[model samples]
Target: METTRYSVPFSPLQERIAREAPQLSAALNHLLQAMGASDFEKYINSLSALKKVDDHLLLITKKEMYRSVLTGRFLPVIKECFAVKFVRIVSQ
Candidate 1:
């Protein structure tokens, strides 16, 4: 079995906030709400117009980001997230 992992690059805004802030939970929550209300999904859906990705891993990566934020743990969280999110698991 070959697994392919696709890494979704974070928006510059998201990365900046995550790296610099300790309390962005509320910000993310609000941002998500705003995105939903404004039909942001359509914009997100267009990212992979050039290619297809695994939605499951995309979600896992997002969860990993939240976990990292909540725990304030770096390194492994970031590493695992990069690996899981960007590294396509291709099993042959």
Candidate 2:
């Protein structure tokens, strides 16, 4: 007997997310390096840019601790780097 396989297609939003994730990571890495915070680059792998709204950017992190660190230490730098008025960091 032969088995058949079916492929699932990604929606436009899914495609946009898939495309944006790596770009977000790269952008963060570059920003961190440029700011001489290369030590923080490792954390970039755990972050994902969910979406943007008005002047704000929504970011998600894999750990709750990262949320605090990012918000407290890096929020201002991130806003400057992305030219965003606000940033919301959420943990998974």
Provide the TM-score for each candidate, comma-separated.
Answer: 0.24, 0.60
Tens digit per residue, CA lDDT, model 2, 12-78: 3224445665555454545567556443544444454356666788877778888888787778887
Clash counts per candidate, in order, are 12, 0
Where is the poorest 10-residue window by lDDT in model 1?
Answer: 43-52
lDDT of 1 by residue, 22-92 (tens): 35434334544545633323322222211113422222223333434423433233224333334221111
Q: How many clashes would you count in candidate 2?
A: 0
lDDT of 2 at 86: 86
